[model samples]
Target: MMMKQLLLSFSALLVFLHFTTILAQAPAKSPAQAPAAQAPVLPQAQAPALTQAQSPASSGPANVTAILEKAGKFSTLILLLKNTQVGEQINSQISNTYKGLTLFAPTDAAFSNLKSSTLNSLSDKQTLQLIQFHVLPTCISLSQFQAVSNPLHTVAGSSEQFPLNVTASSSNQVSISTGLVNATVTDNLYTDSQLAVYEVDKVLLPLQVFGPKSTAPAPTAPATPKQAPPTTITPVVTSSAMGLIRHAALSFGVAAIAAFSL
Candidate 1:
């Protein structure tokens, strides 16, 4: 009995001693351990990097004047737009009515041949219809103009093709297929004497109005209407010359008759 009691006491003492030793010893940890050990998990958040934004005008010519000014080639056209109330119509009235529209402005040289009366008439609402007829919905650039070898749409909602010609002079020019005859880009010290495809006449209409629901058609053209027609007509007048001829004829007839009678 004493032996069995001694065994139980030894077993209890061994277990207690073992538990005490385990409690006394320190826990093992890596030298690099952090507060993460105390917590079950960590929360994270994302941060974005800085970046540059596109400018308001990068998309295209925002307004009529903007395209005019930026396009160096259209400087004269820009000045003309500045002078005309049509520019205001482009900025305010026409632009408001038809949003996302593009216009092709003819230079002053284009209008020089037109009778002032006719040009004035073209400025009114009804006649302005003809002007609107010349625009395109999409923003087209000089390079885009070259991509097409056929007629295209205008911001004015009309279908007009541009004319590209290779002349004997080894020169190329642009023209719009339209009723009004025009002079293609004139060559001088200007433009490095290189040929360009701008209509001698301005294709006037509203501002950048191209949109999803816009009515204007796409100008698939290389239109350059800057040439005088081959045929020209002039009125003939000989009324003043006829008077002198008549007087001389009458005197000659009378003198002949008198000589014959004698």
Candidate 2:
């Protein structure tokens, strides 16, 4: 009985030792760690700088002649500018001396209205003066004319003799007067930093170039007729034959009575 008991105890001890060794070799179950947080990605703006650098700048003429050529109506004015050499001076002064320029341009029809002799009779110097009279040295807008001082000086250089009078009518029509010539702003052709061109109805003629003429006669009203005078009227009378015979008999009786009494 003793030996059987010993064998049973030894077997039980061996089983216990084997389970301890197996538990020691197994992996431990520690608390699980969360995955490392990823950084948030930011969006980038579009590249306008590269686009702007690649685009080409606009190229164009800044002179008055070039600007006028763009519009078709100023052909007549352009012709005159090229013919007179005033166009060169205008471009020079506007680019160098003056800050800006103002021009009163006439249309093809306006030039056609003039008599051939009017411009033909003028000498080259006179023609230049006439062209200069059309331009104001500085740029003047339509609104500026409304508030201008009387007798506005022109580029023509004769401030006293060739000055212009600017007036705005109640109807909103702006007109310029040079005594001999009166014209209105029919259209606005161009306005910019260096040039302003206004279309005018008539060609400007200065009194300095064209002398003064006689005044026009005033119109008269018709005369009325005179009334007739009043007159006194007389009635006509006829003598009767019986009344004449009675008067003769009475005269004979009176004569006989006078003889008897004698």
Candidate 3:
């Protein structure tokens, strides 16, 4: 009877183990399908857009549109912000943050110089190491820039100044600044809000272009050719060779006679 009871217990344990193994072998529901089992509900991709009231006052997406409209002089930039990707982000920041922003915006022609693949890399603005290349972090118009001597920090987040060169403001159409490339304001195209826009010769890159920041040497005034320092000369033969030599000899003889008489 004891052996029979042991056999029955073993048989039950074997059955339990077999059931557990079968359960373990079943396929798992992927993360994609797990929610379906939980709610039998609609997928997340179909979520609703933010209503006006739902948007954050400070960082709402509408701000992007406003920046584009305000900077209509930036024809090329307008199109770039309208790019399939990252355009909206750039535009939104410009709208709300324009109070103190100096955008080193590139012209469409500037971007056209780059290969399409290069532009593709800009799709992820957050990961872009080149933001400082194109943005100034301060409020500066073309006029105030003359007073700004140091390189300003750019939204691209680097200390790089656009060199200012105002040799001629004759046309009133453009202001010139000294730099690796000439920075000029948008000509004849002004928005209701006047932003000093410039079209640069080359893309202003991050501080890496200049390397690390250091104490800039005091700007020297534009150099003047200095007169060669007046040189001192030793008389090789003495005044004896010139008319002064005769005068000196006579004066010496008089001095000798006076000394003898004394």
Which prediction has the highest lDDT against the true structure? 2
CA lDDT of every candidate: 0.47, 0.78, 0.50
Model 3, residue 94: what's the lDDT?
51
For candidate 1, write residues 1-262 as lDDT tens digits: 9999999999999999999999889687668745644555666767554221112333322355654555455665565555544555555543344333335456555545455665454444534444544444443334344555444554344343222221212233444444333234332111101111234444432222211235688879997889987786666568878998999999999999999998
Least accurate stretch of 10 residues (summed lDDT) in model 2? Answer: 49-58
TM-score top scorer: 2
**For residues 77-190, what per-residue lDDT tens digits would candidate 3 score against the true structure?**
555545533445444455566554444556556657655665454445532444335544454555455566455545444343333233324334334443544555543221
The CA lDDT at 177 in model 1 is: 43
Candidate 2 runs further than 4 Å off: 1-61, 169-172, 213-262
Write the candidate numbers in order of decreasing lDDT.
2, 3, 1
Q: Comparing candidate 1 with candidate 3, which one achieves the higher TM-score?
A: 3
Per-residue error at 98 for model 3, in Å?
Answer: 9.7
TM-score of each: 0.33, 0.56, 0.36
Model 1 root-mean-square deviation? 22.9
Q: Residues 34-117, candidate 2: write the lDDT tens digits.
A: 999998888887856431111123263256677568667678778778899889888787766555888888877888899989
